[model samples]
Target: DNYNAINVDRTEQIPMDYTGVMGVPITFLHKYNPRQFEIVDGLNRYTVLDVAGLNDNAVKNHLHMTEIGGKSTYFRVLIKNRKVKK
Candidate 1:
């Protein structure tokens, strides 16, 4: 459960068994607002494992939002174990 050594900024973000992702969103603040899941964030409202299965396409530079105090605020986060420069 302690993924802090990795990309902890990815709220509610758990690891998965896949070929790994190439890129992920870049959020502003390191903190997030879980209360504003729907309006604030554009995420699938499901676990990381759930979304990747639905859309296999590249989602680089995408926009996401999370809610707080009944308000939806846009935020972007990092996707770990990504493609490193060769």
Candidate 2:
């Protein structure tokens, strides 16, 4: 898995078929359910490298972090839906 960021305005937009790590808006915490989802990590440069098993110098330009057209995104939480269909 690329472990790339998946930006969405609403939590409902998160794809249920996707079992890989996804970056969701922080607001998702309000409706978070332990049984349905697993908290992976926060979507940031440091955490992205950790989750990707990469060192600090492994990635340049912080590409692993949620960025769009060279611009960084807002705070996001990495998550995986346990109930996603296989």
Candidate 3:
């Protein structure tokens, strides 16, 4: 589910059956697929979107948002690097 577009040109042909989200970079890892996924890590600072289902074709990066919060600041890479707490 790695996106070559992350480094390569976003206009190049991508393989189907591949699945990964910019916001939810990892999804449906096993037989325990949940109907809904929340931002348990990075909530609203910056993430592309929520990936619910995997039946769709290869999804290109999209600007998606969610309404849930309370996720820890440690989830933030920069915050974790700075050792900040909330």
Best by TM-score: 2
Candidates 1 and 3, the one with greater TM-score? 1
Number of backbone-clashing residue pairs for each candidate, in the order shown: 14, 0, 1
lDDT at residue 71 of model 3 (Cα atoms):
26
lDDT for model 3: 0.24
lDDT of 1 by residue, 10-74 (tens): 44453443233212234433433344221122233222443434223323323222322334333
Q: How many angstroms is residue 72 displaced in model 3 relative to the true structure, after the best TM-score fit?
A: 24
TM-scores of the candidates are: 0.20, 0.72, 0.16
Cα RMSD of predicted structure 2: 3.2
RMSDs, each prediction? 13.5, 3.2, 16.6
lDDT of 2 by residue, 1-86 (tens): 13465666579898888878777889999999999999888765556427666545436644646564666777678888899976
Judge candidate 1 against the unseen true structure and give its global Cα lDDT, from 0 to 1. Answer: 0.31
- Residue lDDT tens for model 3, 1-86: 22111111121222222233222222222311233222223223333232323213223433122212422221110001121122
The CA lDDT at 45 in model 2 is: 51
Stretches of candidate 3 exceeding 4 Å from the true structure: 1-8, 22-45, 48-86
Question: Candidate 3 at residue 63, lDDT?
Answer: 18
